[model samples]
Target: MTDLERFKNILNEHREELEKEYSISNMGLFGSYVRDDQEKGSDLDILVEFSQPISLLRFVSLKRRLSQLLDVEVDLVMKKALKPRVGERILAEVVYI
Candidate 1:
């Protein structure tokens, strides 16, 4: 499968797990993975919107779990905490799942 396809599958898998364990309202694939410009070392960039505020421990745990599952680094951005520029860029290219 293509890298993008693999990335999506991993994302979906993690999304399911996160949804079951947390209160995720929305999630999307962003950055190079979504833009089709990822290199071999590119990490997965994800934007997540939670139904309620999540603790830092939960965020770190989620990132670690996804990184382990996908066999790559994960960069997760909380929708409520994103900077204006980063949010705009991610929103422009993100593919919500």
Candidate 2:
């Protein structure tokens, strides 16, 4: 199967685990995978929306869970809102909700 397909399966398999651990409102795959060019060395960019701000400890735990499941370099970020801001620039590789 293609990487995107594999990603979807992974998402499906871990949906419940993610919700239980992070109290996530929504999760989506972006970057290369969304563009359909994910490869062995390609990283996964996941955008996560949470109902409320998560503590550092909680976020770490959630990251650990995701890392274990995917066994790849997982880049997880959180945003207060799902909507992208006009002229909003994100400098860092990781953003937390």
lDDT by candidate, in order shown = 0.82, 0.68
TM-score of 1: 0.88
Worst 10 residues of 2 by lDDT: 86-95
Model 2 per-residue lDDT tens digits across residues 1-97: 9766776788788788678777888776666666666777887777777877788899878777776777766777665543465114432332222
Clash pairs, candidate 1, are: none
TM-score to true structure, per model? 0.88, 0.71
> 2-97, model 1: which lDDT tens digit per residue?
776887787676776688776788988889878788898888898888888788898899888778877889998888887898778878988887
Task: Evaluate residue 80 in candidate 1 and report its C-alpha lDDT on the 0 to 100 scale.
Answer: 81
Best by lDDT, which number?
A: 1
Residue 11, model 1: Cα distance from true site in angstroms = 2.9
- Minimum summed lDDT over a 10-residue window in model 1 is located at 8-17
